[model samples]
Target: MRARRALLGIGAAVAVTFTLTACTGSAAPNDGAAPSEPASASGPMTCETILRPSFAEQLAELGWSAQQSPFRIGEHELAEGIQCVWGDAEHATDVAQMYGWAPVSPEQTAELQQYLEDNGWLREEDGDVVYLTEDPDVVGYLEEGEYGMTYQFASGWVALADTKESLDLITWRG
Candidate 1:
C-alpha cells in the first residue's frame, strides 16, 4: 500500500511537470504523417508485433528501407524485448531501435536519466516521459516505466524528423 501511494505521488508529479513543459515549449510541427495501423496483441505487447510492420510502412513513407536481418542483445529468442533495428540498404545509414523496461522505482528512473545526461544526452520533457537527445536532430530515448522507447539517427536530420513524426503517430496508440 505504501509503495502504491508513492507511485501515485510520483505519477502526479510527472503529470504536473509534463503539463508545465508542454505549456512552455514551442508547439510541435504538424508533419501530416498517417496514424499507424492499429496494433493488436493477445499477450504482452512485444516489439516485433507492435513496432515493426507499422514502423516499416511509416519508414517507407519517409523514404527509408528496412534491413532483412535484425540484431538482438538478450538470450531470449523473442526479438522485441531484445532489440529491433531498421536501416538503409547500401550504406547501412539511418537506423532506429525500440526497447524498454519498467523501472523498479522512481530512483531507478532518475539514475537512468542522470546516466544518459552524463553521456551527453540533453534532456527534455515530452508528455509524461523525459526524452533525452542531442541538438539539430532528435535522436534519443523517452522512458516511462514499461513504455520506454529509444532511438538513434544516422541518416541525418531528415531521418530524425521522420522518426519523430512516426513516433508521434504511433506512441499513444495501443
Candidate 2:
C-alpha cells in the first residue's frame, strides 16, 4: 500500500510540474505587441570605405594627416550606424568625421536643416547632396539616395575648405 502511494505521489508531482510550466508559458513573448527591429539583424552600412580615402588624400594635401583615434566610435549613440574619425595631432583636432546610416526621412531632413540654419549653418543644394557650411569653420555634407544618406563633417577653416574641394574633385571624376 505504501509503495502504491509513493508511485501515486511521484505521478502527481510530475503532473503538477507540467501544469505549472504550461500556465507560466501561456504568457507568450509576442502575445499582442508589434514586432521590433533587431539591433543587428543586418550588417552596418558604412561610408568609411567611400569617404576615408578621400579624407586621407585631402588631409595630406592640407598639410594634415589622418590617424585613427583610439576613442570608441559611434559615441553619439544616435542610432545603429557607422562612426569614423581621424585625428590631426598637429592641430589637436579631428580632421575628418563621418557617420552614415539609412537615410532619414524628408521631414526629418527638413527639421534638421531648419535647426542648422537657425544655428548659422548655410545650406547649399548639390544635386541630391546638401552642403552646410559656416564662416571660419564647419563644413558638412548630406547626400540622400535610395540606399541611404551620408553626412560628413570637417572642422578647421583650411581643412573644411580643402575637404570640400577634394570632394568636388573626386565626385566629379565619376
Candidate 3:
C-alpha cells in the first residue's frame, strides 16, 4: 500500500509538471540555436528593404539614416510591427521622419480604423489614397510643424508616418 501511494504521488507530480509546461507554451529545445522569427506577410520588412531607392538616396542627401524603432499610438507602443525612423547618422536625435508598417487581419484593420475615428484623427481622401491625420488643416502637404498620418493598404499593411511625405517614401512590398 505504501509503495502504491508513493508511485501514484510521483505520477501525479509528473503530470502536473507536464501540464504546467504545456500551459507556459514552451517549445522544444533548439540545441542552442537562435529561435526562428515569425514570417511576415511577404517577408520581414527591414529599414533597408521597405524604402524606395530614390527616397533612400534623398534621405542620404539630407544626412539621414534609417533606424529600427517602435511604433507608438499616443503613449502606447504597439507590440507587433516594424517601425523605421530617419535621423542623423551619428546621433539619431533628429527623428524628423518616421514610419511603421504591419500586416493586419481584416478584423484588426477595422478595429484600427475605428480606433482612429474614435481618437479624432481626421480622415482625408486623395484620389485612391486615404489618409488619417492629426490636423484637419493638413491636406496632402506636411507643413513646418509635426503631424501624424495613418494609412491602411488593401494588401494587408497598415502604416503610420510622422509626415505625409514620409509615408509616401515607403514601398510596401507586403
Candidate 4:
C-alpha cells in the first residue's frame, strides 16, 4: 500500500513539473505586447550607401582620384565624405565641370567670404586659400560651382542642396 502511494506522489510531481515547463515555454503570453519599431536615420547617409551606384564615385574611377575620408578642416568636421583628388587648376575645373559644380558668382563669393570669416578663416594673398590656425586642418578657396559663387574647402565643398530637406539629409549625424 505504501509503495502504491509513493508511485502516485511521484506521478503528481511529474505532472506539476511538466505543467510549469509548458506554461513558461508558451509564446501566447509573450505575444500580447506590440514590438517596438526600428529607428529611422535622419542625417547624412553613409558614403558606402551613396557611392555604391558609382554615381558619386564616377569621377574617381575616371582617372581622377577620389576616396571617402572624414577629417576636420578648421571648425567643420568631414566624416565619411568624398575627398576628390586635387590637381592643377585646369584639372580641377575639368573635374568640377563634369561634376556639375560650375564657378560661383560675385555675390556668392561674398557669402563664402563671410562664411570663412565667421569660421575664423583669414584671407591670404596669391590666389590661394589659407587657414590661420597654428595647426590648421582646413583649406580655404574662392571658386565657382554649379550654383555660381563658390567657396571651396580643402577636403569638402559646400553647395546649395536642391531641396530644403536635402541639407538635413547630408549634414553630419554623429
Q: Top model by TM-score, which number?
A: 3
Task: For candidate 1, give the lDDT of residue 161.
Answer: 17
Per-prediction TM-score to the true structure, in the order listed? 0.38, 0.36, 0.57, 0.24
lDDT, candidate 1, 58-159, per-residue tens: 445545543332222122221222233444455654343333222123554455556656766656664444555443333223323322233321111111
> In candidate 2, which residue pairs clash?
none
lDDT value, residue 96 of candidate 1: 39
Order of candidates by lDDT, top first? Answer: 3, 1, 2, 4
List where candidate 2 sits over 4 angstroms from the true fold: 1-43, 50-78, 88-102, 137-162, 166-174
TM-score of 4: 0.24
The TM-score that candidate 1 achieves is 0.38
Clashes of 3: 0
Clash count list over all predictions: 1, 0, 0, 13
The runs of at least 3 residues in candidate 1 whose Cα sits more than 4 Å from the true structure, single-residue gaps closed, are: 1-46, 57-82, 88-105, 135-163, 169-174
